[model samples]
Target: MIPTLILLGLVFGRWWRSSLMAAAVGWPVVLVATDVMSIEVGLLGASALATMNAAVGVVVHQMILRMTRQLRPAGSSRSGA
Candidate 1:
């Protein structure tokens, strides 16, 4: 899920959009998995977990982007004129 979200975010060029998509994709799966396993997780608990997962995914994605940007030198494209 984290990888998918990050890839989609990169593809779409929008971090928040990817984050939202992660929540949309994750909610139903989590709910159904818990149901199938007969795990008693309430709505609030499931929602909280999903939210946290999305938040962490977004933060990690942003950190990677920041690090990549920092690695590039500022004058790389400029010719020695």
Candidate 2:
């Protein structure tokens, strides 16, 4: 579940979208599987964790993109010379 959320963040490359996706997938389970008090506490706790993880994934995705851009030769074509 954690990895899936992170992957969602990486794929989406946006924190809000990733969080929404996580909530869409997770909220129903949390709502159905827990008691009232647990639902309240768990939703908050899970939301925070999911947001943090998604943020981390977004950071990682940005870093990878930056690194790839840096590594590529400037104005280079796909065909080797």
TM-score per candidate, in order? 0.52, 0.60
Pairs clashing in candidate 1? Answer: none
Q: Give me candidate 2's TM-score against the actual structure.
A: 0.60
Single out the weakest 10-residue window by summed lDDT for candidate 1. 5-14
Tens-place lDDT digits, model 2, residues 1-81: 578667766877645564556655575466557653354556777777766777677778888888988999899877976
Could you tell me which residue pairs clash in candidate 2?
none
Task: State the lDDT at 34 in candidate 1.
Answer: 67
lDDT of residue 29 for candidate 1 = 69
lDDT score for residue 57 of model 2: 74
Go through the candidates in order and give the C-alpha RMSD of each one to the true structure. Answer: 5.5, 4.3
